[model samples]
Structures are given as structure tokens and as C-alpha cells.
Target: MTVNTRELSTIESTILAYFQALNDADIESILDLYSEDPVMLPFLQPAVVGANAVRANYESTFQLIRFEVQTTIQELVEMSPEWAYVRTDTSGIFTPIRTGEGAPAAFHELFLLRKMGNEHWQIARYSFSPAGALPPI
Candidate 1:
């Protein structure tokens, strides 16, 4: 919730909220960023389809490690009025919750956000891959 809006557009702010949620390991806040039917393609994992599956994925993930990444938005394109895409590169460390082992983590992410008529934008599809080309998120 400490995200800064400043001169960012709504879409950018929404994406920043996502990163903040990840940093805080806030499951409900993360879920709120998604559309009704969200799809996630995590590294080396089967595609998570639908809201329930997405929730499960993040819940499982947050239980293992704590994210502390800084995201650099590479591109923000308005594909259409109701749809847009954001490409970001994130780099930081993830600390294992149990062992307290911190590991450097870097990835590139693509987020497809959709907004309905007079509604706020929500993520419809998301994909991220490790910069090293291995390991799972």
C-alpha cells in the first residue's frame, strides 16, 4: 500500500500495486488485481487457469519465499481501449521463509490487463520467466 502514483497512469499504478502486493506477500491484494478469469504462466510450471487456480498458485508460492524485487517497466502498450500490456524486468532477492536463505532473483514479466466499461483495470493474463532460464516461480 506504500506504492507511489505521482505521474503514473491508472494501468501503471495498478501494476505497481501488484509489485507491492508481491513484496508484502498479500494474497488478497494480489488476487484483487486480477480479472474474473485470470491465467498465470509461471516459470517451469503448468499454466494456472481461472481465479481459483491462480489463488492456489500464489498461496503456495507465498508460503515458501518472500519476494523483494524492484520492477522496471520496459514497455506499456495500449493494444486497444479496454486492453493493454506491460512488460517489466524485476531484480532482487527472495528469502526462504523457513530457512531465511536469500537468493538473487531476476525475471521478465508480461502482464495483460483488461478493463470493462467504467471499471478499473485488472490482470487477465500474466507470464514470467527467470532471467537465468531455469527454476520455478
Candidate 2:
């Protein structure tokens, strides 16, 4: 789906900060961006709920490699006063902790975000996979 100019906002900037926090190994900063009761479903894991689980995931991934999330928000559809739907393509290079070798991973995700009324957005749901012909990225 394509999002016209009217649908675009500075949300992408926030998302970019989220990625920067991860790459900086700042788990706390990343957690701060999430809702207290957020839900995250990673490409390789079962659904993980709540802030604690989300933190754990970020930490675990950090242990594996430094993650750099490059996200392109493709569409933004407002759902309500506090909610919006976003589709994005995220590409990243994971630099392994031990060897510092990097592997690429790309994600195509559909996310739901709710405004917390504090100038912050919390993800409600995130689902993604590679394009049809390609294997999970």
C-alpha cells in the first residue's frame, strides 16, 4: 500500500530513534518507547507480551549482534484519535557480538501504534515476513 503525503507524519523520525537506541545498546531507551503492556512478535520467536518480554528480546538480540534497523514506512492509516496502522520495510545489518561479522535481514511489517498522549507512540501489534517469493528475511 502507498501512503499519500497527507498521511505521512514525523512518526518515521520516532521509529528511526527506536532503531538508533538498539544499535547503541541502550535497551532502557528502547523500552521507554514502548507501551507498558505492548505485544511483540518477532520473526523467529513466539509472541512476547509486556515490556519485560520486549526488553528481553532486545537484550538477547544485542547479545547476538548489534542491530541497526533501517525502516521505510510505506503506509500510514489513521485508525482513531490515538491509533494508526503502519506498513514498513526494515533492513538491518546484525554485527555479531563475538566476531563482529554482519548478516543482513530485511523485514516487511504491519504495525499498529497507539498514541499515549505524551507525544509518544506505543506499538500494539507488529506482524511481518518477507515478500511472497522470498524466504523469511
Candidate 3:
């Protein structure tokens, strides 16, 4: 099957916008990237479901810290005409507002993106986990 460059570009941009919003600490922009009923599975945290809950979760984090994320799209697969999945490697530095403590963080993320109609793609599901440590074999 032939790959549609325009569709692929749109999907990639949507993923980039998500990280950009986080780095900018723009909650509204972040929320805009997600669907009405989206799910986020963050590293070491319980699953956060729904747009409102996702908003709250980001709000709480943005309150204490701001992130600067650099993402590498490892893989992107078109599941259908309207659905796609992306795997990315993300690394960033987060700085705390109150104490000024800053630390580097890295994670591997899997995102499911769905095209709402014809013009836009939004995140349907997102999950990420720490990237460094390897599990025991």
C-alpha cells in the first residue's frame, strides 16, 4: 500500500504539538490535542481517563513543574484510514517551581491517534514508561 505523506505529516505534527504544549506549560493546548474521552497511562501512575481528568492531571503537574521535551518518533503505523499508532522516545528536563530542583527524564511512549473527521487528528490513548532500566530476563 502506498503511504500518504500528507496524512503521515498531520499525525506526526499532532504528536509534536502534544510535547510542545507540555514544554510551553499550556494546559489548554495540551487538552486540545486529546479527544473528548481519552486515556493517559503515565509512568508509575494510575491511569487517567477522560478529558477533564486528563486536564486536572496536567494542571497539577504544571503547577509544580515545567518540562522541556525532545521527542524522537521511533515508529508510526497506519492502522486504518482513520487510525494510527506512534511509538516515540522522549527525553526532557523538568524544573520545579518552588524548590528549583531540575532533573532529566526519559521515557518510551505509545500513542494512538484517531482522525475525528477529515481535517484533524487527536490522541485517543497514550501510554508511557521509563526508558533506561531493563527488565529481568
Candidate 4:
């Protein structure tokens, strides 16, 4: 659906906030942006729904990683009042399991979000691809 100028701006900021939060690695702030029943489409995995589940997913992954996972936004598109998308190029050291220092990897992700309630936007879908190996961090 078409959104007016003001709401459009809000959605745009919300989409941009995704990358901003990731870059900042402020998990609390990111969590505040989500709805109680939001959905998440993580890479090569089953869909995760609800704020609690979404937080759990990230918390589990973050704990395994020796270092933090960060992201940078490459492109973003807000197509409608309830729909928007972001493409991010990411690079960070991550550990799938507990170990010393895990290897660093580079990847890109496309996130699709939907606005819920009266004013909050939450991730509804996403797809990810490994771009290539990144420089050692």
C-alpha cells in the first residue's frame, strides 16, 4: 500500500535503523525496535517468530561467536507503508561454535520488513548469501 510522505519517512528511518543498530552492536536498542509478535527470516534456517524468539536466536548466535557480528547497509528500499527492504554488506569475525577466534567472513543480506501496530516496523522476511571470504579481523 502507498504511504504518505510523513509515514514514508518514518519507515525509511526504521529500515535504516536496522543497519545502524547492527553497526553499533547495541542489542538492547535493536530489541526495542521490534514488536512482540514480529517474525524473522534468517539465512538457511526455519523462520523465527515473535520478539522473544527473535531475541533468543540472536542471543544464541552471539554467544557462540568469539567476536561481534556487524553489518553495513549497502541499499534500502521502502516500497509501501507496510513493506520495506534493506540490502546490507557484512564483515565480521564469527564462531559457529565455541572455539578460540573464529574466522572472519563476508556476506550480504536482504531483509524485508513489515510495519505493525500503529508505528513500528519489524522484520518479516529475509535472504542471505555468502559473498566471499573477508580479510582477517
Write the residue-wise lDDT of candidate 2 on 1-137 in tens digits: 44444434645555667667867999888787676788887666799888778888877877776767677878877766677778888787756678776677777888787777756666677667744332222
**Clash pairs of candidate 1?**
none
| Number of clashing pairs per prediction, in order | 0, 0, 0, 0
Q: Write the per-residue lDDT of candidate 1 for residues 31-56, one digit (tens) a residue.
A: 99999999999877899999999999
Off by over 4 Å in 3: 132-137
Q: Which candidate is the best by TM-score?
A: 3
**RMSD to the native, candidate 3?**
4.1
lDDT of each: 0.87, 0.71, 0.87, 0.67
- Worst 10-residue lDDT window for candidate 3 reads 128-137
Clashing pairs in 2: none
Q: For residues 1-137, write the lDDT of model 4, one tens digit per residue.
A: 54476765665576567656755556777777675566777656898887788788767755654434567777767787667877888777655554465677777888777786676777676567667753332
Model 3, CA-based lDDT: 0.87
Count steric clashes of candidate 4.
0
Model 1 is weakest, by summed lDDT over 10 consecutive residues, at 1-10
Order of candidate numbers by TM-score, starting with the best:
3, 1, 2, 4
**Roughly what TM-score does model 4 have, to 2 decimal places?**
0.66
